[model samples]
Target: MAKKNSATKLFVLDTNVLMHDPSSIFRFEEHDIYLPMVTLEELDNNKKGVSEVARNARQTSRNLEEIIGTNEESLEKGRSLGIKGNTHVTGKLFLQTTALPHDLPMLAGSKADNQILGIVSYLKNIHPDRQVILVSKDINIRIKARALGIAAEDYFNDKVLEDTEMLYTGITELPEDFWEKHSKDMESWQENGRMFYRLTGPMCPNFSVNEFIFYEFDKPFHAIVRKISGKTATLEIIKDFINGKHNIWGINARNREQNFALNLLMDPDIDFVTLLGQAGTGKTLLTLAAGLAQTLDKKIYNEIIMTRVTVPVGEDIGFLPGTEEEKMTPWMGALEDNLDVLNKTDEEAGEWGRAATQDLIRSR
Candidate 1:
């Protein structure tokens, strides 16, 4: 209820938070962690069996034990988590032993969620000078805490990116007047069938190797920032993958981003390729098409090994039957679907040829 300050605050962690990240308690650099007794009970109850949840529960128990040690007295007062091994945690850990008085709504019931909420309210009421926040991974718990006027939030320490839209696209669009401003002292030369321009300007600092740069004012220009020497940058025109002789496996890029992606994807010199996009954005299709072109057509690589992280939806249908490939067939549905599109690229290649190509791909 109090306005947050620079002083170290108290964070009441839920069982799911600990299970999500066993090292979460230490992630709060200067804040204190308060663990309710019910959270420990939940962790203990879950610390059986061999599932990921069970493993996480066991790890959480171990982490708690290592933090608490053999001193119950220290925990009662407050145990400093800044041990020698983990000097990052400049905070203390507290354990709730005595029951806290609460005025939770009767409809809330006496579940673990309500208990954690009760403890948060109690901590807020007692520690009026400090901020008390509840951290959990459960959406419903967060909603309930907010309804009860308790400050609650999701555990974001494990987030890869706070916003996917903010991810860099490896491309920068130059201003329309870029040439008018920075192309005065530019020098040009042609070598090995590629045109390179040496431009010295204020934009050189913004240039990085392999970053795509394009300008579309008056005369359109599409180039890549190949190198930078002090205040000068070398810009090489990108080989048009659309209509030029650079099409990949009958697939031509339609847009600037797609062109950039195709240039990177089909480059045998570039070993690693990472593509990020939303569904229906042609990420898988483009990657597979490039892969087929390189592996089956050009013989750039011996084989293409397709793999994905096996995240299950709902309850898993345990123990799929078949060979390793057959068992993984369900997960490779996206690859198969994309292959269907790629196979149609060669219309003259009859049904037999398509089937043969599919067989060759699977065999590889």
Candidate 2:
């Protein structure tokens, strides 16, 4: 860590730090906020990117320009200068010089990043008494800065928290006369919304089904009940793909996340679904089987829309690739193999489940 810059630290805000959290300069509160000139130049250059992140950066820059213009003078006094939420700006807290080479590449060999580094190096060398901190949201930039002997750190306030965790017990066993030993407690168990069980680590359950009871492990890992039979089932996960069922495998659906992906696929309001999943998980097999059941047999969707990433793992499709589709064909060839896995051999002879998936997509 660089020496702390009194209450008014001189912070060189990297382009990425601003993009990650537009309000960062204001966050330091009445500090010497330094915006690298190159950072602004690069943001202006990225105004045309169609990504959400790019749009946000452009918007934030425009907003900042308005603030800097409004408080052009007071910012130099090192006092509160801008909007209420924003800390007072201090005039151009940093000076400019073409100290860095302009010949560096824009991205692959970014001149902006190198220039920001140069500015920090300049400040550190000339103003040894002042705390010169380079704030960047890019992990790689921070690493590169450290490698070049610049004091760099990540802007952590904008980061999101990860979800909490819960432990899983794969197996639970009850003695042969299970109810007899616990009968006295069974009546009050369901009544008081409590289910308690004794844990013995001697046994473990393998490839399981309903027998592996699910419970809320927060209290005791044994207090809750798996209600598939009579109690309330907290949550049920359909593990195996039904023989001819649609969407049984590769559940890349987003419901389990934010009720996002799968719901989008199933909603009549949505007309398109693009799923990406890994191998041996029935990504293709599940859909094809469903299509057969819903479509040709009983009209559902007009047709199925499918696509492949095209590039195989490790090898680049662009370099080794023959024709675009030809290169991608082998990847989808797995879909053909999955179709064979479905009982599609006698398609016209009987009720095929292929229509189920096709019709399902259309209905959604």
How many clashing pairs in candidate 2? Answer: 26
lDDT of 1 by residue, 21-115 (tens): 88888889878889998899999999899888889899888887888888746356677788747898888888876777654765366788888
- Name the Cα RMSD for model 2: 10.9
lDDT of 2 by residue, 27-133 (tens): 76555666666887877776777886688687767666655565455443432335644435442244343343333233245567777777777777766777678
Q: What are the models' TM-scores?
A: 0.80, 0.44
